[model samples]
Target: MSDLVIGLGGLAMMFALMVFRMPVGMAMLAAGYFGTVLISGARSANALLVTETFSAASNYSLTVIPLFILMGNIASVAGFSSRLYEAAFAWVGFLRGGLASASIIGCAAFAAVSGSSVATAVTIGKVALPEMKRFRYSDALATGAIAAGGTLGFLIPPSTGFVLYAILTEESIGQLFMAGILPGLLLTALFMAAVALVTLKDPEAGPRGEWVSISMRMRALMRALPLVTVIIVSIGGIYLGVFTPVEAAGIGAGLVILMAIGMRKLDWRMLQQAVSDTVGTTAMLYLIVIGASVLNPFLALTHVPAMLGEAMTSAGLGPYGVLLLIIIAYLVLGMFMDGLAMLVVTIPIFFPIITGLGFDPIWFGVVAVIVIEMGMITPPVGLNVFVVKSVAQDVPMATIFRGVIPFWVAMAVCLLAVIVFPQIALTIPSAMFR
Candidate 1:
């Protein structure tokens, strides 16, 4: 009868639907609609639905989503991602586990344009895996680097995860993007370190790649210049306050399209495919957002977040202690849920708790994203691992999982570092925005 009971039941039913292989958006929409009707009657529920649908549809900030997705898709079709890998390989391919390290660098660079982890992994893995194999790189090191590197997609600027978080929390998308820059770079370095450590322990696992000539390196760098320019213009423009997030997306997408056309790479077929993929990805993201929009009000009416916050405070867990518990919950849930699904479902409840503890929402967004990144590589449902496995079909699933372990530890270390010094994630946003 009580709103609290209704809310609790709705959550249980939603999870049950998910267990039955229902889509996350559909499950949430169904639960929220019925729960709202139960709590506030059918008339109120109908109005709520109408207004939420309209609000989600008309949101101007959401334009950035499709544009950014288009930018990445177009870049992929243009072969810019391959150039990025070649450039990184030219520079780092001489060291032990160099090709693997180059893969991480390439993934980081591509992630600046493409915001999806699976896309980054799949795109770079296709280029890096064969090269690593040619050089006799061990399957574990090769696969591990690709999977871990893919996670940079979530932490780097233009990240879809950050975009969704910004929309949900009413945080500034530009600020969140800036907040991610430092942490993204830090994790990339940590991944490279993981590769070095792995190869150091077993030289046979990651033999040195062929030495590239200086002239060849320069040529590769030149080839990658246009993409680097696009990244600097889009992301750097945001930091300088020259371009709004939406404008940056448009410019980025436009520039990539122009480059593809200039290089004669943008055929009618490629353009059509890029647009189609963008539409599908955008629709999926919007559905998740709309579902969260519908469910959020229902949860608010039940006062569930408030109750949970009070319970957490009363349990004698200090702010940091409470945050730790929440992080642990994310790690466990991440094993079974997609990162974005986990974000949309949990942020409504956790955002309030986090802000109530006097933490900055922007900082928490970065932390949450990092934890989500960890989830993408965690076993049982490590999405990136499976992505790499799909590319390297002959590699055992267990082997890829094993390869990702050191990188996983590295991610854990990066998480702790950010927690200890929140400024690692906040300084850029604070300085630039001020």
Candidate 2:
């Protein structure tokens, strides 16, 4: 058997393992290892596994993952997420569908601290869903807004999506983070527009919230300042070149811990929980990185990415056509696979193809993230939708999925805008680095 056939078999086995409920990291590791043994010897596979595991675990840049996760966990335990929603509510809750809009704004704000989409959805959903229900907002719009908005956690600065992409592609983390900013904001705005259109069509779906006094709004904003300040200082420090991404993460985590303690919110138990959660999440991410590292070598030996690239380029599809096809594949794969798993699996194959077509890697990172974000709210395997359902248990799964439709459409628009005008993702990064 040919090395290419072995590689294809390995890919199939990995997906089959995933489908059978095996953890994605393990599945990839198993596939990569056994596949290597098929081509090389057991000694070579063993050596590859040991070396890659150490390399992935000891990589200095990966420290950013835990620090940022710790910062987010500390913020959540300290009730900063609730305060964020309160502040957003004060500012926008009076407009039609304002509560839903506030949820989106709050998610965007919380996403600055939390890089995980599931965490963002759960954190904001717990705070906003009850209030929207009290205000008689439609279940569909309320839940959908939270589900869709949570994806910002991956697209905003301080994003794990960008971090993983950087690790895989060896791009500048700062540039990818900067590239995400305008697109994140643009998507947020588009989501808000979706809410407006929904409320406009049926005022009864989203009733107008009572206006807040200016003083009250100011107070709420002040109460939410800790997280906002942390986001500005940590993320802003990177853009200003005052801190590397790792330094920014460390400072962000430390500042959040101090702020929580200052507010008397981080008791010993709460602190333990935050640390425990961060460790668990960090370990999982490390495993995935290791798996990808091991698998990449095996795939390289098979020359699969090279073969795929040649086939794609020779198929007479122009760059845009290939891009569109890639996006469609992502959409379908996303419906069945976890976002991070999909990223690690596909980037190795597709990155070469995309860059070979002369597209900017930084811009492609943003575009890829946005498309993955859409999958988070897509049907059947929509991770964020399930997260929302978990929060609003009484709301049917169908209802939550139904609600995300408009926001999903908004995300498509954002994706297209970024595609047509690459500067949407490039401008901030360019100006910053220049």
Candidate 3:
């Protein structure tokens, strides 16, 4: 078969496996192994598997993934996420839709320490859902807010996504982490604003509550001092060259664990659970990734992406038009796929074309992350939606999905801002480096 036909066939097979509920990693691994054997014969495919798996697993970059994952797990056991939410709530829980708004802020804070969207969603859902429910917050609003807020986990600093993106794109993790701050805040603000506005327009979604005293707010902030210190020290360390991203993850993880122990929130069982959970979660992510490594070579062998890139350029779409198309594609894909799986399947093809188009790598990285953030809250297979749905089981799955709509809108706007201004995403990296 022609390479395009072969490529298309392989892609179809992979998706079919996904539809069959095969793990993404297993599906990709199977498709890649078979596709390679079909196109290039057994011996060549055998060598490809050994070498690709080795290279993929052996890289220094991939080490960052498990470390970040481990750190999040440790922090989760430390009960740091609860404190973060309570801190945000004490300040924002008084306004219209403020409970929901507080959830978003809490998610952002948790993301600084917890890099996984699912972890952030589940953790925040546990802490904020009960409080929001007690206040008679709409099921849709409460559940949706947590799902949407959960996405901030992957976009904020110490994000595994950002770290992986830097590794794949060869951008500086420190700078990419730094570049993320403004855009991260921009996305969070957009989410909160959407929550407030939607609740304002539909008062039933959020009931009004009394504002708290300044003393209370200040005390609440003090309660989350460990998180604040971790953020400052880890981010400050990375940006200031005092530590690499990996080293910073260690520091953050250790500090959060120590604080949790100090607070007496963590028991021996919780600590064990943390380690076990981290290992399981990390294993799942790695499986899909290893599968991608095998599949990626096959995808390249087919040359479909390169051919498509050429065709896009030839169609008079220009670089920007193609970029627009890519963004739209990501938005659509985000609805159906896990963010990392989507990234693994797509970035190899997109990265070359993006760099070839002369777009700034740092800027595109931020934009891609925002797009992925959109995916985390999207339906069918959105991790964040599932996270919230699992925690708030009484709230129907559909309601949780619907609730994410406004935040998705906010995400869309944030995405556009990144696209149009570019500077909002790039200025920090550019300034710091130059």
Instruction: Please tell me which predicted candidate would have the highest lDDT against the true structure.
Output: 2
Global CA lDDT of candidate 1, please? Answer: 0.94
Candidate 3 lDDT by residue in tens digits, 212-291? 89998898899888778988898888877798887888887788788878889889998899888888887887776678
List TM-scores for all candidates, in order. 0.99, 0.99, 0.96
lDDT of 2 at 107: 98
Which ranking of candidates, highest lDDT first? 2, 1, 3
Q: How much is 350 displaced in model 1, in angstroms?
A: 0.8
Runs off by more than 4 Å, candidate 3: none
Give each model's whole-structure lDDT: 0.94, 0.95, 0.84
RMSD for each model, in Å, please? 0.9, 0.7, 1.6
Is candidate 2 or 3 superior in TM-score? Answer: 2
What does the lDDT read for residue 296 in candidate 1? 93
Model 3 TM-score (2 dp): 0.96
**Weakest lDDT window of 10 consecutive positions for candidate 2:** 308-317
Tens-digit lDDT track of model 2 for 1-434: 99999999999999999999998889999999999999998999999999999988998988999999999999999999999999999999999999999999999999999998989999999999999999999999999999999999999988999999999999999999999999999999999999999999999889989899999999999999988999999989999999999999999999999999988988999999999999999989988999999999999999998998898888998999999989998999999999999899999999999999999999999999999999999889999999999999999999999999999999999999999999999998999999
> Distance (Å) between predicted and true CA of 244, model 2?
0.3
Worst 10 residues of 1 by lDDT: 308-317
